[model samples]
Target: MANRTAMIDVGGGFRAIYGAGVMDRMMEDHVHVDHCYGVSAGSANMVSYISGQHGRSHTFYTQYAFRKEYASFDSYIKNHNYANLDYVYGTLSNHDGENPVDYEAFEKNPTGFTVVACNADDGSTKYFDKSDVSYDNFDIMKASSAVPVACEPYVIDGVPYYDGGIADPIPVQKAIDDGYDRIVVILTRPKDTVREQKKDIGPATILKRTHPEAAEKLMNRYQTYNDEVALAKEYEKDGRVLILAPESMYGLNTLSKSFEGLERMYRAGYAAAAAIPAFLGS
Candidate 1:
């Protein structure tokens, strides 16, 4: 029914009755929906900020924006006949297709806060643990029931950086020079260290933590975001780059700052929500 709901009523009904039976004597064809709408992984942090941020004004405004953007997709499916043929969304199931790895919380949290969450597959999670899993081999643990991934990768050949994090200053400047009017960089630390005293475990266990190759690869992926941020700020482009650091051990706050110190992250998120579209556009 779900699959049939996507086709035109006539087409679907025909398929339900004569099409399948007649084709059964000969051959059958399979069709699949390839498009969908949902909260982008890029915007998850922004959504969390809207929910947890301080100040009712900021929260309400950000929440409204979120609802508007997300709801637009729903409206799109309703008005467009072809939309149902595409994969419309019901949930943010980004991590649905990965093996459940453990989240190890043994890392040092200098700021006593954790703002980012890391999963094994796509370095999408905030932090990676050397002792737990390496970026390359981590795909082995993807969940069995993962939804058929439909989104294509965003690729740029000439640019040196791959994967997400704050764009480094030089590249950022180049992007701006090429006509990116305003740029906002959202930053997050790895999860597992939500607070000073509370250590969160990763999704996987460590069978071998001392592997040098795995450790180096994991460290590079984890450290590059900060390195890019520092490099970006060095370019001196007024406010060309707005850095959104959250108030959690998972973010940029150092241990001395205290988890409470990370409160600014929420505000940063709210500010970014208001600024991202305009910032990215102009």
Candidate 2:
């Protein structure tokens, strides 16, 4: 069988069950995600999947990640000082304060996991590995999903960082190096049915007011995203990438919307992941 890795994209708050749910279905259907690489919210899902990120059987993230715990920053802030009204941290240090996703327990063993984040100051995509690093899942989670305005950036190696999707939405190259001959990517963005006009909008229009600079950078990257999407399409054409579209996906990046519609995304993920065989066989 060809080695495989799923390259999941981060869509800020829009990434509830998109990645994790897709991953679970893939495993259940025998599509087994041998390796996973994710950015932004996708990074959060990686941590959950690696830790069996559930409190009990059939919990499937519902107990913790999907509960009011992750849905709002209120409860999490009691345990973490880094939390803000918009940005949050320190929840997954351990699963229900047990089954910690530490490097000592998880390093260099079992399935592969990689988390990606961007430098807040320079807008660079940096990658972290589960097998290669001594850091815990919480550390990776902070850096991977640290969007400039929405959350506080993790001070990793003394550099401030933000969402990795700004630089590497789909880390296809990294997945290739990780020995996955077949690559699967799940995007929170639905396929565009109509061309979007490239009109300049204020930072507040594209990013939260708190992240002024990164917001400007993100708006500029919309064009850059076009390039990455083109490259992904090329991979699909060559049979190197198997893309799972967000069929009927709404709310591109907002937690409330993602939470409100968790079941929908979960079922959508199941359907999308189930189609992998057809994509591969075709």
Best by lDDT: 2
Model 2, clash count? 0
**lDDT score for residue 132 of model 1:** 27
Q: Write the per-residue lDDT of candidate 1 for residues 1-282, one digit (tens) a residue.
A: 121101000011001111112112111122111110001222222212222212322222223223422224453456322111112111221123121112222122111111122222343423212232232222111110011111112212221111222112113433344443344343343212122211211201120132232223234533444454565565325655544333343222211221222334333334334433333333
- As for model 1, its CA RMSD to the true structure in angstroms is 21.8
lDDT of each: 0.25, 0.59
lDDT of 2: 0.59
lDDT of 2 by residue, 98-169 (tens): 334544444544667788877766666678877434553366666766555445666777887776766676
Worst 10 residues of 2 by lDDT: 79-88
* RMSD vs true structure, all candidates: 21.8, 4.7
Give the Å error, residue 46, model 1: 8.1
